[model samples]
Target: MEVGQVLHMNAGTGETSYSNNSHLQKKVISMTLPIIEEAMTNLYSSTSPSSLVIADLGCSSGHNSLFVVSELIKIVEKLRQKSGHQSPEIQVLLNDLPGNDFNTMFKSLPSFQKNLSSQLEAKDAGPYFFSGVPGSFYGRLFMKKSLHFLHSSYCLHWLSQVPEQIENNKTNIYIASTSPPNVLKAYYSQFQRDFSTFLKCRAEEMITGGRMVLTFIGRKSEDPTNKEAPNSMWELLAMALNDMVSKGVIREEQMDSFNIPVYTPSLSEVKSELLEEGSFSIDRLEFSEISSSTYYNEYNHSDVSEIAANSIRAVAEPLLVNHFGDGIIEEVICRYKEILLGHISQEIIPGITNLIISVTKK
Candidate 1:
């Protein structure tokens, strides 16, 4: 059986998590991939056979994998055709959490391999390879000079571990747990550690001129001094949880146990970090509001319900099931959805998101 199942939510009736927002995903991909492809073409001269390896870190199961994989293969084929070189031995790696549904990812591989092989065979191009490397992206995964191009979409910003302070607390003392000073500091420190690790790994894994294109959620400001407001998304999420607690859908004590497993980096912060690592040069940085048209936005009964349900399945439901207990998930999700539906809209979405930062190795 596939490790993951297709979303059965009907969008109109249930809650939605942000991950199931297909419109958001598509918009981010469209804005980022072109710049990445352009950079790859410029960095790698197509005149000669080049061994190329491309990796997608934090590639979760289901639709995310499907879209990213298709994009990677398409760009690689384009590069090969444009360069008129024998296709390099292609290596694509997908990394994610241990609990991530690799079964769904594996099931999709056969078709991908068959199709790519047939295309390469038709063109008499060199062989292509596909593999899944399952693990956290906070550490190294390859040998020196092993990669030609690297990409990570919507994943790098997550800290390796939730802050110990928040995790250790028995009561809900933090105003907004996700952005607690201690938590943010811990997440930033982890970002520093993991990012440095990423650069060190890439320096060893990438050729001198290899390219890397990364897209992740980023804050617009460089200021660590900014305070989160009550209307902030993080706070809104806190409100939703509070409502669930009041309804007895979830334990009030569990609130402290639930923190978003992510940290949003600012542009200045990213640039400073990249330079510190000295592994790559910034090529382009793009940021924009994701379009809602890419989603099932008709707001009709069935579509809305489906989208909402999928959202819960994609993020909230899974996290609750993992952290709190599966037994309370359905009821918790029901209450959480009620809170979210009251606040979350395609508009008024807090946080400046969809950051695409492209860099080339020195």
Candidate 2:
């Protein structure tokens, strides 16, 4: 499947919406805050361009998107005031797929503007502007030498499109223990192509000293089929789908053919890709684990499984809907919740190890 057109977080502020259920992603953004701050600090101090151009690739819907812009604004404005220099024109560009819920995101800008006015002083404030660019970051999204800093959190693990010729890996949505050798190669190859293109595109668009901070789910081991691999949530999802098939809720072929365009690479794989591209110097590489229990804290329930499943639903529902139709969404989520309950109870689900990397254009 073409991810750019179909892959998006569940929209709106409903119970199952990404906007309401994005605490996990917010956690990721917060964990990478120090890296983002440091990069912004360095970019602002060294270049001090007349216009500070910034782009947040894969800026999905909801508060998490605006929260990033707010932080960048505060950081730059503070640096300007401290140096006693006239503020640079800060133009923030938010990029995501065309299918993203930009309307819901744009609707919240009024409050974002109001909050920004309260947070920063109006004195000598350079005019800051924001424009949404709907496109895939796997290719170029801006003019050459235009961007000063780039930030993307909880993205990049998704391939530009689903891997081809994985027909043998039936019933497994991603790289699972049961997947064949060909399936593994297909996923990694697609990631290499997609990530290499991403780096090349960004290198062309960003200035010489520009820095980018990227945070995404990655595995610790070189093995892609580890029991607790970064994308195990999808494995549990596959179990649910198979159960549905047995119950005649969905056809066996429907479940067997469905595969998400997500690939959680090992740290070594990421390093290899970056080395091959050679567009950016690696400044920092670190991984931190965030608990699945911590990802859900809305109603204060002890059932961590359902909470975790709900979080997964917010992110995966759209993709499922695009593939299987929306009629089975409720059933799939519920079955997935039950499957997760058993899975979480039987074993301690390891929290996802989020990889945070800061790189500078060479």
lDDT of 1 by residue, 1-362 (tens): 11122111122222343334545555577677678778667766632336667787777765556566566666666777876666666677776666666676688778866775665433655466677886666666776777777878777765665545656433332223334466557657767777777777777877777778888877665643243221144454456567767777677667767665556777777777888988788888767654333343457534444455455455545555556677876655555455545544434334335668888778
Global lDDT scores for all candidate models: 0.61, 0.86
Model 1 scores worst on lDDT over the 10 consecutive residues at 1-10
User: What are the models' TM-scores?
Assistant: 0.80, 0.96
Off by over 4 Å in 2: 293-303
- Residue-pair clashes per prediction, in order, are 17, 0
**Ten consecutive residues with minimal summed lDDT in candidate 2?**
293-302
